[model samples]
Target: MRTLIVTEFISLDGVIDSPGGGSHPRAGWTFKDVPFVEEAYEIKGREQLEAGAMLIGRVSYDEFAPVWPSMDDFAEYNEMPKYVVSSTLSNPEWHNTHVLRSLDDVAKLKQGDGAPILVHGSATLAQGLAAAGLVDRYHLLVFPILLGDGKRLFGSGDPHTRLDLVECEAYSNGVIKQVFDVVR
Candidate 1:
């Protein structure tokens, strides 16, 4: 069986929405308060190198598909087999993109052979996967600032899930890389 890993750049208060630019009042929070630390983002590069495929929600797919294809920084992601969980998305224009309708489909994908499937910027999807006990790991870069109101990475009503810390590092920019293995 393959592992399913959910990765996010989350805030101190657990907010994961709009780390990049968006319509939110505090959108683009990742770059605003924190100074750029190349070392802080090394995990991202490693994730691309290690991931066999990429999985994301419809919202993230929509946000990424439009621009990631043209970004050299995301070249690996652009070329990888990408799965978007969405019932409404009939056509995906991105290269090697596939649509999976539900979390059951995600579970089936996890049973297939390959390197771990990496999930990025999919808060709702991640929550669902976590609640369903489908997520096997979490790679979180916790920023030091707090945005009290926003969509968070973990939901309130989700069933309790235990995690064992696999690795952790605090960057000079105050962004901490926390890698956790979801306890089965």
Candidate 2:
């Protein structure tokens, strides 16, 4: 069976909406200074190379499909199969991209034998997966900042999902990377 790993770069105050620039005022907060340590790059590279495919939501796919294909750095990410979960999206323009109709399809995908499926910057999808007990693990890179007002990683009504810390690393720039396994 393959693991579905949901990853995000969240703020101290729990905001994970836009680590990259977006509509939020603190959208580009993560880029204020380089927070990545050398080891961070190594870890990310390994994750990218080893993952069999990426599973993203419609919003993330809309954002990434336009850029990743043109970047040489994301070659590995682009080459791997991409699965976008959406009800509205019918035709995906990006090469090697597939559409998953619903979260139920994702649940089925988790039962298949393959490399781990990676989910990045898909807040809505992550929330649904977490609520449905479909996520196997969470890879969170928490930056030292407080975005007091923004869409948070966990919504107020979201059901509690307990996680077991599997790994943690603090970078020189105060960025903390933590990997947690969903307590099933």
Candidate 3:
């Protein structure tokens, strides 16, 4: 079986929205005068290269498709078998991209044995995956700041999903990387 890993950069208050310079009031919180951890790149680069595929939500696809394809540093993301989950996205122009129309499409993709399937910065998709019990692991990079008001990882109405922490590492910049296995 393939593993589905949801990776996110979240604030201490569980806010994962617009961490990458989005127009929110607390946007760009991930890189706003914080201590830089050099090792983070190495860790993330490893994961990016190790992942077999990229499964992103519509919102994230909109934000990323234009930028990621043009970047040279993100070669793994640029060349991977990209799956965008969106009912509205009828056409995807990015390289090696495929449009997934439903949750059933997502489930079908995970049926075969392969390297890990990675999902990044897709809160709605993450919630849906959690609700459907499709998330195998969560790799959360928690920043120390608290963005009091923004889109969060878990909404009040979302289903309760328990996770077991399998690994955790704290950086000098007050950023913590936590790896959790979704408990069945």
Best by lDDT: 1
TM-scores of the models, in the given order?
0.98, 0.93, 0.95
Best by TM-score: 1
lDDT of each: 0.92, 0.84, 0.87
Predicted candidate 2 versus true structure: per-residue lDDT over 10-43, tens digit per residue: 8888888877766788677778644556665455
Candidate 1 TM-score over all chains jointly:
0.98
- Error of model 2, residue 10, in angstroms: 0.8
| Poorest stretch of ten by lDDT in candidate 2 | 33-42
Candidate 3 per-residue lDDT, tens place, 25-122, comes to 87787887467788754557878879999999998988998898888888988988999999988779999999999988999999988999999888
* Candidate scoring better on lDDT of 1 and 3: 1
- Model 1 gets an lDDT of 0.92
Worst 10 residues of 1 by lDDT: 16-25
Query: Mind giving the per-residue lDDT tens digits that candidate 1 earns over 1-184?
Result: 9999999999999999889977668999999878999999999999999999999999999899888999999999988899999999987999999999999999999999999899998789989998889989999999999899988889999888889999999999899999999887
Full ranking by lDDT: 1, 3, 2
Arranged by TM-score with the best first, the candidates are 1, 3, 2
lDDT of 3: 0.87
